[model samples]
Target: MSEVQELTKTKEKPLWYVVFTYHNAEKRVEEHINSLAKTEKYDGLIIKAEVPVQKRTVSRRGKIKEIEEKIFPGYVFVKAVMTPEVMAAIRRINGVAHFVGGGNEPVPITPEEVKRARIQDDLSEEFKAGDTVMITDGPFENFIGKIIKIEGRKINIALSLFDREMGIDFSPEQIMKIQ
Candidate 1:
């Protein structure tokens, strides 16, 4: 193939690269890259930016809430046809620490890794409220508890402690449904 043909072939397929950003700046970096991608100069070279996140349930002060937590904090995945200009522009963006690779060149992430990172854990579908579960890990191991509430991946269970009924929150991995 001719040099021009090779270049065209390469540019046709955008690759996913990992960009390291400042603390708590993943979203900012992703937005900046995506906005720049829409501009004429970067229209074809920069495809899109993504910050993989998963829904999480947290109980604070007896209140259950669902939150989106970053799967990889301080990192953003950018899909683009990487070139010298594109890489330079990304590095110049605020909050972007650097591209994740050796030396000054950025390395593309494998498709398998990207797919794995995007997978969200939906543990709430496996168990429901009012179900009996046994604590599988932590100090409450082997203890039986009744599920009182389930928020995303967090499960609130009521169990006997010190002869008193109390509620505690646990992740799906920390509890198993009683058959």
Candidate 2:
């Protein structure tokens, strides 16, 4: 690519923000933000919204199904150097509960943190679906589960909490990432 092309692409990145969205609102929030991006309300302000997604597996009567699951429930990441109008539009977006930072002041998601959650495509595996594991933390402590698949950072676990065999979905931070 030419130097000018590289420069244009580099300008696309901005300070990132960790946003707290309404329950089950990650997709809608992202869509709204992206749509607003084309309007003049956010002129010259560039924002990249991301709702990290993962894959999930479900079993029904001896059959398995795959589903797309969000990595951070009720949360979405936005990369943009916020201007006054940009911030205003963000709050107006549907399914946006609030920003994690204190007050209305804008905060950016660190480049390092974003990089930490980066996808590892080469080392990926269709994890041995159905391997039992124990939850190390979160609200569900000491809980054991059966792994259905390993999709990015999320895991679809078949957990029996009091004989109710329900499927619990979790991210890397919510459980022990290691075996």
- TM-score of every candidate: 0.62, 0.55
Q: lDDT per residue, candidate 1, 1-54, as tens digits? A: 764344434534457899999999988898999899999999767878889889
lDDT of 2 by residue, 1-179 (tens): 86444444343324568779878888888887767766676533644577877788999789999988777788878765576767777888877878878787967755467776552322122235666555656888657677776776678888887878888887643443223
Poorest 10 consecutive residues of model 1 by lDDT?
A: 4-13
**What is the Å distance of residue 66 in model 2 from its true position?**
1.5
> At residue 118, what lDDT does model 1 achieve?
89
Task: Return the top candidate by TM-score.
Answer: 1
Task: Write down the RMSD of all candidates, one decimal each.
Answer: 18.1, 17.7
